[model samples]
Target chain A: MAWVLEDGRPIYAQLVERLQVQIVSGAYPPGGKLPSVRELAAVAAVNPNTMQKAFAELEKSGLIITQGTNGRVVTEDERLIRGSKRRLARRHADAYFAGMEGLGYTRAQAADFLRAAEGKGEAEDE
Target chain B: MNELIEIVGLTKAYDASHIAVNNVSLTLPRGKIIGLLGPNGSGKTTLIKMLNGLLTPTQGSIRIGGQPVGVETKAHVAYLPDRTYLSGNKKVTQILDFFCDFYADFSRERAVGMLQSLGVDPNARMGTLSKGTKEKVQLILVMSREADLYILDEPIAGVDPAARDYILRTILNNYDPNATVLISTHLIGDVEQVLDEVIFMRYGHLVLYTSVDNIRERHGKSVDAYFREVFAC
Candidate 1:
């Protein structure tokens, strides 16, 4: 999976977001074992403690659960996955609206653009 | 609970006016890699020097393995200074022999292997090698010894990225699991991943010393990020 990091955001939070994206994208299927902290850190070229913090955040968010010896595994709960996706969508929406506002576009104009984009997305899906 | 090295109110002064290391107290345990981080002129070098008996503490005492720093403790300590200590005219073989003679724990086989891997000839004179090669040779010599404490000061400084990787990998591969390695450097981001604990020093005083895990938990930031924030004026 690709590691996406923002300069302003904390490293661990970026890690958590990357892991979440992977999980929601089905790269790490439900109940599948996630990579160890060291392995993830090596892959992302980040500190192991940062990876550990990301894993802990994942656990706290109920997206993953750790089992002794078996290591951390993706949670089997569909609701948790959907919730994360919704949260991600909301964050993107917020950013999109904020950008539109900065560009002097009204809320109605932004909504119209989003609707057109959604229609194009539906056509592509079909 | 497992204190391998301890310092209580350790203070070192070069003169009556200037203090190199202020009243510092800390305990370091075995089986951990510690990053002694600070900018230049910060007492990291002085503190490390005291640990190896290169300099005498002016006021306080340091205990290694429950005993004070002395000649006996020197046997168990391996030190790699920031500056080049080996003579430029000496051959690698001559240096190896000197280490073997002076340190009982020095391993000739390991030194040869490390040198061979780096494409360094034991017969070659130190003066002929590049600066990076010299640093690698120095690291090999220090790591070849089976010491309880390895004090490395700025091992990656003045080297290219590739050499830095090799030096870091060599330290990781050669270090004894039971021993403690204290590395002092200003390059925190590069070595932060491997470090178990980090000690931050500012102007000859230790500002922070805590586990990496604790730092992340408390600050919600990577050690590098936290360092930038802490040191930012």
Candidate 2:
């Protein structure tokens, strides 16, 4: 499926993450119309009811707005989108560190490894 | 959402001996697809039969739309048994007419439209079509109803993956928004994504009533994987 769901998390949570990324990353641009619950549900291969719950979460976070029966639209507020992006980045970093910790690596080592990998790519470009 | 189905202390026992369905109480809300799941001999079939009025409960009660299971309730519920109850020597079109004559809610245009899409020959006899095609036709019939509760027993059991997808989509497209669809199946993986909630049964007892996503979130496993672990021998 286009939407990948990780294990050990409610679909609502995964949906929130995926849609948050979509909004912040401009896959769903600010002020763009969001797919209806049924459309999104079919795309994700989930029940429409579950999809509704996900949309409700997005609305609560101010990442999407539902204007009566006009359906949902991505929030036009740039600050909200930026906040979502920052929060998502921090969560990703925390997860990366946690996974590295499982492999017996310290936060400093993980950061050094990431920088070294980025430098190698830059050097290849040069 | 109102309670579409309410079962209070429901049980079905044979001769006061073997309990097919133990005393169970549950309320299924409208406008959701609920999976009734279990292994062999888990009272799943019995529970469904009771809901559809095919078999009367030995004790307690089942209420549909605030009314007990009876003639009025039967009108509001559409049931697709594991076997195609409509199979006959007649041609496919004739059977469509039969359903239209029988079920006031059956829509001839919708059913014929689906049949046309599937390329089912209207003149073909029921015995002539392939097993998969016949299953698809039967599914189309069940979904043509505008009933409040749809009880589908093993709708995806024998179909191929492509046919299964078509069947699930047909169900999603044809349901009334306020209706409840209770599908009984062992094919958990194929149907999990479409189910809003799941009811698990074992040995004629209600074991778990949970959402498919809840199972994923809490156990880190799909409904199929969890079923395997829960019913492991």
Candidate 3:
């Protein structure tokens, strides 16, 4: 839900990705109201117009919708959210495997690392 | 909501030999915060003065809201000069009164509210206040006006980092959504985030005028970093 942007990328694109995370992760609950452009821009410390652009992109992606006087709300479409989450996971996995390959690890070794990391997390839980 | 300000072949020279601003043409749309950025003595002040009608342009046309730079445009612009414009002897409250009397858009309530938040005493004499306090007072007066364009010059120059943060936040929060704010400063790092577009100048010639997002995406650098590389000596 927090917005942290690196310098080189377009800010609105980053904002769109961040908002997608918020919506798909249920931090902004389905059918819940979204903050005003000015409010969100202030929070992100970015120009309001830039935030507007991000919101427009999010709306276009079906993650958010405006309901007349109701302003903008997280889409009630559960399938859309689930689909977006899966897509993001796929993109991340692709990048992770690519990075691991660059570091001389095969896909099987990368999967083993993930399993080991998951086992370590369970151990910490105990 | 149309073009708020337009400059066509705008040029300025103190004498026939040396030009301070040279044949710069640009259009500023309504409701955007523009950063006029350049190094020292890059003619930022001269261009601002021409826009405010404080100084006459040598040649070319400058229009605001389709009108030439005259009383009408003057009334529509809220200008914060690089230095204190108010006489040092006047009390802060008296200066506020003067602004209210002169500009129809001036809101005494807004001025007072802004002053209170910045911890500026209205009753204090301008001459007696410290340098930073004076800048805050000037900001309060300028932002009080409901003008269509606000031209702020070196607003963060003299202040400390803490005060600079406050000034940037105030600028972001205060302006009406329809009013265009054009701020001229060399302190790119501090104001880069809030700026929608930036106008880069070098030796009085505009080198670039582009959106911050585009500069970030295309140049692969922060505005400050790009500025350093572009204007590197």
The prediction achieving the highest DockQ against the true structure is 3
Instruction: Check candidate 1 and list the clashing pairs.
Output: none
Residues B1-233, candidate 1: write the lDDT tens digits.
47889999999999988899999999999867799998788899999999999899998899998889998899999999999989999999999999999999999999999899999989999999999999999999999999889999999987998888777767766645578889998887777666778999987788999977678768877788889898887
Ranked candidates, highest lDDT first:
3, 2, 1
For residues A1-126, write the lDDT of model 3, one tens digit per residue: 225577788888888888888988999999999998888887777788889999999999889998887789999999999998998899899998999799888999887877877878742211
Q: Model 1: per-residue lDDT, tens digit, A41-103? A: 666655565677789999999999999998999999999999998898888888999998998
Give candidate 3's whole-model lDDT. Answer: 0.88
Best-fitting candidate, scored by lDDT: 3
The residue-by-residue lDDT of candidate 2 on A47-118, one tens digit each, is: 888788889988988889988999889999999999989999999899989997997878998887778778
Query: What is the per-residue lDDT of model 2 for residues B117-186, given as tens digits with 9 covering 90 to 100?
Result: 9999999999998889999999888889889999999999989998898888787766456999999999
Native-to-model Cα distance after best TM-score fit, residue B72 in candidate 2, in Å: 1.6
Best by TM-score: 3
Candidate 2 scores an fnat of: 0.60
Question: What TM-scores does chain A show, candidate by candidate in order?
Answer: 0.87, 0.88, 0.87
Work out the TM-score per prediction: 0.73, 0.91, 0.92
DockQ of 2: 0.52
RMSD after Cα superposition, model 1: 5.0
What would the DockQ be for model 1?
Answer: 0.15
